[model samples]
Target: MHYLFWCKDNNTSTPQDMCWVSLRMREQHFPGHVLCWVSMRMRDHLFPSPWQRHDALRAEVGAQAGAADTARETSTALYPLIVRQGMDKYKVLEEWRAGSFGATCIVKEAVGDGRRFAVKKVECIDEHEANLALKEAMVLLNLQHPNICAYKEFFITWDNTISSLFLSLVMDVSDQGDLGGIVRLKRQLVKKMDETVIQMLLGQAIDVLVYIHKQKVLHRNLKPSNILLKDEDSFLLSDFVVETLAADEMKLKIRMDDECKLWMAPEALQFSYSEKSDVWSLGCVLLDMMTCSITNDAEVAALLQEIRLDPVCLENVLKTLVGKVGYSADLCQVLLQMLQIHPVQRATAIELMDVPYVKECLILVGSPLSGVKKTLPPGVSDELYEGGIEKALEFMQIYTDFEDAQISALRHLSWYIADQDGWLCIEEIIRLVVQAMKLHSDSLDIQLEGIWILRDLVSQALAHGLNEECFISNELITTLVRGMRSFLPNTGLLSQICSLMMMLSANEVAAELLGKAGVLQDTLKIMESSLENRELCLSCCGLLWSMAMTESHTRREWLVYAVPVIFNLVLKHLHDGQLVESACCSLWILCLKGCVVEEQTESISWALLESLHAHPQRPVLVKNACLALASLLRTSELAAFRVLVPVSGKNGIALIKEIYHLHSDDPEIVENMCLLFSEMAHYGDTRPEMLSQNMGPFMREIKVKFASTEEIVTLAESTLSKLET
Candidate 1:
C-alpha cells in the first residue's frame, strides 16, 4: 500500500498540499478534503468529502465484534495506511506499531519541508465511536507537555473496505523509539540501565503525570511501550486512548491481553480506574526497566501478574533488583507507595515529587520547581545556585516540547541570574528562548516567558552598565519584533514585548535591527488598539522614541499613522504621568524625524502642554514636555498659533511659567523651556503670548541660574534675544 502511494504521490497525485480541516470545519472543510486527496484508490475506499459527514450512526453494532484484535495479527506491510493528510500529504515510511483498533505509522511529508511525523489511525466502528475517538484525540491535543508526545493534527474519515470509520492523529515522532524497545535490547545484552537514565525517565514521567492529573485527564495506558524515548535523556508518554472504565463497566475499547493484566492495578482489573491506576502502571514499567538486566521479559511479566494476587511479593522483588544505585532504596520505597494495591493507600504522582529520592531526580533533571512547594533549604539552594544553570539548560534542551517546564526553568534561571556576573549567559538564554518560542509557537505562555527572560537579561545589562555585546544582538532584536507581530492584540504580552523593544532600541545597532524588522509599524498598531492600557501605551511610546533616534527612514511611514493615536492617548492617559512623559518623548522624536503633517501639529502641541499641566510636579515629565513643545513649534509654524488658546484654563505660556516655577532647580527643564520660548519667539503669531506672560524676566532668571551650563546658557541667551528683537 505504501509503494502504491509513493508511486502515485510522485507521478499521479495532484493538489500537492491539501490540509485536513474537516474536524474543525463543520461550516467549511479542508480536513475531509485532505482525506480524499491522500486516498490512493480514491474510488474504492471511503473517505470524508468536503461537506460529507455521518452526524448520526447508520448502524449501532460493529460489522464484527472482537475483529480489531484479530486484524492486528496480520502484517500491516501488506496494507500500509496514509494515516495522515493536512497542509502536506504524509507518506507512510514504515508501520511502527499496530494495535487492536488502529495502527501508528512512521510517515514523512510528501510536500513542503519534508518533516517526519507519526500518524495513528484508529478505526472507529460507528459514528458514536468516531465521536468518542475525536473527543479522545482532542484530549491529547490539550496534553502538550515536553514529556508528552505533541499532537499535530487529527481528522475522521471512512474505510468502505472494512466498513469502518477511522480517526487519524498526527503527532511528533521520537525517532529513538520507546522504553520497551530499549529495555528489551538491554535485557538481550545483559546490560544494566544507568542510574541517571532511570532518574531521567521516572522524574520526567512523574512530572508529566502531575500536570496531566491536575488537568483531570488520565494517561489511560501507562506502560513501557507507551513511554517513547525522545532522546537519551528524555521520555514521552504517548497514545492516550481515553478509555472510560467505570466501577462496573468499561466503555471504551480495550484488549484484555495478558500483558495489560500484568501491569493493571487490582482495582483497574475490577473495571474501576483512577489516577492511582496510572501510578501502578508506571511503577510496573519502571520495575521492568530496573530488573531487565537479570530477568527475562516472561519472568518480569509473571512477577508483575503475581503481585496482584499477593501485594507483599513486590517488596521481595525490589530487594533483589539487580541495578541498585545511590537512590535505589528510597526509589524502591516510593515505588512501593505507587504500587499499592488499594487506591486509598497509594501515593499520587504529586506526593512522589516530594520524596527525598524523587526530589533528587527532579533536581538532577534540572526541573526543581514543578509541583515541589517547600522552600529549598540553604544547602540545596547553594548546590542548585552553583550548578543549576547548566542543568536548567539541559532541562530545556531535553524537553524542548514542554512549555510548562520551559517556563519554570526559564523563570528560575532568571532568579539565579540576578547579579551582573550572570549577564554573560544572555546569549545562551536568548538562543534557548528563541528555540523554545519556535517549538511552542502556538503557546502564548511560553512566548510570554521567553520575552520576559530576554527583557530581564536586557534590564540587568542596562542597570549594571554592561556593554551592548552582553545582550543586544541581531537575533534578540529579530525575536522581539517577531513576538510583536505574532501577538499583536495580546496587550499583556505586547506590553512586555514593546517594553523589551524599547530597551533594545537604546543601542544604535539594535535600534537599526528593529527598524529593519518593521518594529515601528507594529508599535503603532498595538498602541492604537490598546490606548486604554496605560502601560502598553507608555512602552509603545518609548519604543517609538528609541526607533526614531536611529530609524528616521523607518519612522517616515509609521509616524503619520502614529501621530493622531499618540495625541489621543496623551489626552486619554494624562493622569498617568509616566505615560504622558513617554508620549512627549515620542512626539519630539517624530518632529525631529520631519514627521509633522500640519493637520496633526495643533493637536500634538495641545497634548504636550496638557501633559505638563497634569503632572507639573513630575520633573521628568516637565522636562520632556518642554522639549516636545519646542520641537513641535520649531518643525511646524502652524503649531505655535494653534497652541495659543488656553488648555484646562492655562495657555501654553501659563503652563510653561507654572512648570518653570515648580522645577526651578532642574537645569534640564530650564534648558528645554528656554528652547521652547526661543521656538515660540521665532513665530510672530505666538511670540507676544510669551512676552505678555513676563517671559523676558523668566529668560534672564534661567540665564543667570544656569550660567555655567553651556547648552542652557546658549538657549536662554537666544530666547531673550529673540523676545527683545
Candidate 2:
C-alpha cells in the first residue's frame, strides 16, 4: 500500500508539500509511528545536489515537514505527549522540602517568563515504584477543580550514566503553603478563627472530595498537610494517590502506613478503604484545623494522642470543643456523622454535601444548591382549606404527579392548615394527608412533609382537648415510628418527628401505643445520635416526659434509657435554660414514679444540683431541679441524703432559705421548697443540717407568704412542727 501526505502553507504561491510513503517501510522503521520516514528520506534524496550550497534552506524544509508529520502522529497517539520542554526549561529557585519520594522545589520558567510552579521530583528506586509514580501522575491529570491542586504537566528524565529514571510533576504553586503551616502559625499566635472561616474551609474540602469520589477515586492520604491553601480564602486538596476499586468492590485494601494512621478511619486502619474512609480523614482534618485555632501544637498533639489511645473519646472531646469553639449545632452534627467509628455509619461525600451545615456553607461561598427551589403554586392554599375537603383533595392529587411540587405544596398546606387550629381537622383532610404519606413512603421529602402535617394535626388535637384516640390510631403511630427510624439521622426531621411524638404522648393510650411501637427506642436513638442538636434533644425530652406520665411499667421501661441521656444533656447544656428545664422536668417525672435506679438517682441529683447552682437566675430550671430533688427525697431517705450531701458545703440549707426568700411570692416554687424542707426534716442525716441553718424565720416567712394556698401553708407548718419536735 502507498500513502500520500499533503501539507498547506500560509503562502499560497508556495507549492503544497507532498510526500509518498510505502506502508512496508513505515511499519519497520517507525513502530511508534511517531516519525515520517519518507519525509526524512525525501529531503535528503531531493536536496543532495543543493545540500552543501543551500544547507540552511534544506534544513528549514526538513524541519517544516517533520513538524507537520509530528502534529498528525500526536493526534493519533494512544496518550498525548507531555509537551517536553526538557528539565532545563525550569530553574530550581528553592528547595521547598524533602521527602522519601524525592524533593519538592520552587521552580520558574528558565526562559524568564516569570511564571512560578511547584516541581515534585520522585526518584524511582525500582520499576514498581516508577509505575506507581506514573499512575499518580495520571490520576492528577484527570482531576480538575478549583479546590483541587491543578496538575500542570509531568515528564520523565533518564540518566544513562546511572541507568535511572526520575519523574517530575509540575503543579500550580500555592502561595499560602499547606494547611498544616497555616494552622501552626495560627496556633503560635494564639489566633482564634471565626467559625465561618472553619466552615468555609471544610466546605472547600468537601467540594474537592465530592468531585474526586465521583471520578471513582479515593484520596487515601488525606490530611492537613495534603490540603493546600491557594490563598487566604481558597483551599485545594492535594497529593491524591488513587487506589483503584475492583469492578464489584466498593472498597480497596490499603497497607497501614504509620504516618497516616492518625487520620485513617477505623476500617482504613485495618487495611480497608472506601469513600467513607476519605470522609473520616476529612473529619480529622477539620478537627485539626479547629483544634489549632484554639490551642497550641503541643496540646493538639497530646489531645490527638489521647484520642488514638481511645477512639471513642474523640466524640466526647469533639462535643466539649464544639461548645468551646462556638461551632453551630448543624456543623457539630455533621462532624459527628463523619467521625462514626463504624465505616458503615460514616457518611459518604454525596451525603456530606447534603448535610445542612455544608449546604449553608456552600451558599455562603456562593455555591447555590444543586437544583432550583420550587415555588409553591398560588391559590393551592385556598383550594386546600377554604375551598372545602373535596377541593383540597383535588388540589393535592395534582401534585402527586410531580413529586417536588407535591412536597412543596404539602409542606405549605400542612403549615397553613395547622395555623387554622382545629378547624382543619375534618376527616376528609386527615385521610387525604395520610394517603399522601403512604403513597410517598419512599420519598424523604414527602415523608418529611407528612411528618410536618402530622405534627400540626397532633398539636391541634392536643391543644383543643380533642379525644386523641379519635385522631391518632395505632397504624398511624406505627407509620410515624417507621418514618422516624427511616429518617433518624436527619436532625431536622427527627426534631419534627419528636414534636409529633410529644403531642401524641399527651394521651395516655397514645403514649402506651407509642411505647409498644418502639417509640421509646427510636427517641433514645435520636437522643444518642443527636447530642449536638439542642432542639431535637428538647423535643425528645418532652416526648419522654409525656410518656413518663403513663402507667408505672411504661415509665420504668423509659427510665432505664432516659436517665443517662437526660443526665448527660443536663451536664452538657447547663447554660441552656430551656434544655435544662425540659431535661430536669423529665428527671422529675422519673423520680416521681420512683423508677430511677440508685446509680441514676445519684447522677441526676449531682447534675441537677450543679446546674441549679450554675444558673440560679433561671427560674424554670431552678423550679424543676427543686421539684426533681423533692421527688428523689420522697423516694427514700438515702436519696434525700444523696441530694443534700453535695450542696452541704455551700450552706445547702442557707441556699434553700435564700431561694425561698427570693421566690417566696411564687406559688409553685414555694410549694416545692416547703415539700423539700418537709422531706429533709424527716431524714435524720439532713435534719441536723436543716436545723443548723436559719430555719425558724425562713419557715415562718414561707408559712406567712403561702397563707393563701392551703397546700403550701400545710407543708410549711408541718415542716416547722417537725423542727420544733
Index of the highest-TM-score prediction? 1
Alpha-carbon local distance difference test for all models:
0.68, 0.64
lDDT of 1 by residue, 1-725 (tens): 11122113444334333221212212122233233212211121132321011110011002111222333443221122234433247777885576643578889888789899888876654545555556545555545456888777677665545555567888888778899898999989878777688888878888788877876787767888788888778888987755522221332236446776676788877767789988999988888888767788788888898877777798788777624423367778878898887789999988888788888887666563343323333343233344566766766786664566676677667667664355667678778887777555556887887887777777877877888766666555655655676687688898898888877766655765676567788788888888888878888888887776553225356876777888888878878887887788777656644566877788777777778778888877776676667767766787787567888986778777877887788776776777777778897766677788888888888778878888777777888888777
Best by lDDT: 1
| lDDT, residue 162, candidate 1 | 59
Model 2, poorest ten-residue lDDT window? 32-41
Q: What is candidate 2's local distance difference test score?
A: 0.64
- What does candidate 1 score on TM? 0.47
lDDT, residue 436, model 1? 78
Residue 388 C-alpha lDDT in model 1: 60
Q: What is the lDDT of candidate 1?
A: 0.68
